[model samples]
Target: MAMTKKIPDTIKGANTFCPGCGHGVVVRLIAEALEELGHADDAICAVAVGCSCLVNVALGIDKIGCPHGRASACAAGIKRVRPGNLVFSYQGDGDSLSIGLAETVYSAQRNEKFTQIIVNNGVFGMTGGQASPCTLIGQKTTTTVDGRSVNMSGVPLDIMKMFGQIESVAYLARGSVHDAQNILNTKRYIKKAFEAQMAGAGFSCVEILSPCPTNWHMEPVDSMERIAGVVSAYYPIGEIVTGGGLNA
Candidate 1:
């Protein structure tokens, strides 16, 4: 009998994320995408503070830890200094949309040569579930136990649509990992982002609608369903930008 051998890859480590946390799934999908493109060795990832800061240990890649909301800037610098390597930034909603909004916007505006993966869980999971920029209307968090009110907190920012407005952004997509079909689509979108960057087409971003069971106060399975149902309903999953006439 022949034994099946497990291939050595970047995601060969203990699971560090909470149960039902979507960050691990997103990281695994990204690693698989990197392997599929044969760019794992040449890839440099910048991680931001919050739940995604420990992704370096999870993915075991050439990663650098950046301050809250600065992963895009770090990734931009890395790509500029080492244009030969593939660069990507992994950030959470609080990191990317709240504190790092300026960096994220500027990088996209300038068309930085890198990819950005934004995990939108709608709250600051690492900091006791504070409401974030992507928190949906009527959603409850630690800070907003009565549910988010548009009058008090305003509305969730449409990040994908905002990035789509920038001509420098070559590709932009929003995906979810709540279902098998969505998971497969998310994988495909991530792979496309890698390919686009490798082809030097400019910046690309994939916003993943992730789940936070701990903060949501739901069972793991229930949280997954909520992510698919409630979260996906608010943030529809699909490609928003396709590089226009530019080919990867």
Candidate 2:
């Protein structure tokens, strides 16, 4: 909990995120990392649509709104034009791994010097409870009325593992925010991703397994439990890849 301290000049309004959601937490971690690294004032965030848009409410720095699934591309452009700025993309699983897959892959392949923080809640939180590309097997969403059927929907995309094949990628990790210990670890992973960017190591990314109680049809507490017990199990937390290797 202590990892979050809103930056000075943050928008003076309550965040619109749902109760117990993790998007706020992840955004705060990013803000903390930017401040600690002395880039808070120069940080440029490209936020994608869906629940990701709400993050701007609490973000204090300047930002741009990227078209759905285009946060990575936008961030890449920002970094290219203003190489001194700390640029990062904030996107949801549905946006990053679904509509934005091509851009995300190409950016990593190019080793764009930037950071990405993806909040994978398994469902499309803002646009109805639809199953996202990261949805687990048997996970139910509004679209998956009877739980996810791998035969019909195919397997959940193992993006973190897939990123390991990209030699240009600097760091890749998946962390959940369902509990205190994982929150601390997740913040660390986020910081590492930013540090990688600052070092010009290469493209950096961290996937955060967040809870979506409103869309998942469960209590907030239950959603956290699902992330801790099942979601993380399938995703396999910790650093999946570090410095472009399958280090997990």
Candidate 3:
């Protein structure tokens, strides 16, 4: 596919995600989805720190840089103020599910009229590959060199399953970008979440299981393979909740 031409007008500059990081793909998908949904000009995004922070420069949309894991809260504030605008939060697993957990949960509880995208790349890609809330059992991150044992780290937080039960959440899905087919599916999930927000269906979230080659310390292709195999097996893929316009 000629992604260059597909680059929507919403993208202003280049992103700084590592060479093999999946954040870039997710960013492109967001831009395309917003443009396709006719909300490019009306969209505002709150971006969390970590690798996700790099998206600030890439997306031309009005963006707010939240402290640490406050992206959801920031996005919620924006939606509350400008109820007519389309707002979303771009966050990393570590950033959203950890310190920002309260914001994310409350946003769903209130059924905020906005969208959220969480990149679940297992490790904290931006800060030396530390263990994150989504890091899988037996996974080896810098903080978990001996592998994440069940006793030490418990279990990886299944964001989709955990959040799906929130009655206020109008839509929820988890996808990957390890391959072409999965990439398309992930894009569809993102677009659907955005559509749910546009329809005023309340809070929507799409969790993307992405590869962090630089953090995983593997070849780019090997990291992709890990996502297609191990990571996907652990997190699974597809929509976890259905409501609003989520099922296009």
Candidate 4:
């Protein structure tokens, strides 16, 4: 029998994301992963400030709103206390890679047993299109109106590269949601990240390259194509790590 798509009960209310925003897709994928892992009723989500805050209302699971860039710390505490529950943190580039960089790095250093899903749209979508740590050189944002300059900003951070160096990081992957096939593949990566946590393999994170049509001042379709043509070029897509134990 053919399979039908289903939205887990964890998600409720209108998605409310803009036409081409990838947050909605990422949220749905996370919900599906939790349900598939039988964590629908047992998952705790720590959401950071920014657009990620919406996940609390969108996903019916127990959720805690963490201070900006502090979701990782919050998730770590929740996981320790709830040890038996599935714990994950949802954050955006601005919140996770910029303001929350320290929290993120140390959590991996300690091998926190939880999943961290970062939406890397490169721009600060919630606070106008400002350049974020993941914003590419030559990319234009409100702060970098002309274009990002390496001399001034250094370089776009390759978070996976940093996490890959940490001994505690059991799984690290980058995925995109620009097309149907990639979306499905991203879901696979997300699921594996969760599975790694369940196996007690340590810190796991899935960084998803998403599109921001509204912020990019492009039509929705154009934004999707841009992600295919430009964004993915720097970020790339694939499982960078799958834990030493879980093959592929």
> Which candidate comes out best when scored by TM-score?
4
TM-score of each: 0.95, 0.93, 0.94, 0.96
* Number of clashes recorded per candidate: 0, 0, 0, 0
lDDT tens digits, residue span 1-248, model 4: 99996768888968877777889989998888888989889999999898889887788899999999999999999998888899999999999999999999999888788889999989898898899998888888899988899998989998998998876578889999999999999999999888888888788999999998978889888988988987888888999887643332
RMSD of each predicted structure: 1.9, 3.0, 2.4, 1.7
Worst 10 residues of 2 by lDDT: 5-14
lDDT of 1: 0.88
Per-residue lDDT tens digits for candidate 1, residues 102-218, read 999998898898999999999999988899988888888888889999999898988987887887678889999888899999999998887888788888999999889988888
Give lDDT tens digits, candidate 2, residues 20-83.
Answer: 8888888777766777778888889999999999977878888899999999999999999998
- Runs in model 2 deviating more than 4 A are 1-13, 244-248
Stretches of model 4 off by over 4 angstroms after superposition: 1-5, 245-248
Predictions in order: lDDT: 0.88, 0.86, 0.88, 0.88
TM-score, cand. 1 vs. native: 0.95
Which 10 residues in a row give candidate 1 its minimum summed lDDT? Answer: 239-248
Candidate 3 residue-wise lDDT, 1-248, digit = tens? 55554569877777888999999999998888888888899999999999999998889999988999899999999999998898999999999999898898888888888888999998888889999998889888999999999999899888777677776688899988889998898889988888788788889999998889998999989999998888888898998877743233
Model 4 clashing residue pairs (backbone)? none
TM-score between model 3 and native: 0.94
Error of 3 at 200 (Å): 1.1
Better of 1 and 4 by TM-score: 4
Model 4's lDDT to the true fold?
0.88
The stretch of ten residues in a row with the least summed lDDT in candidate 3 is 239-248
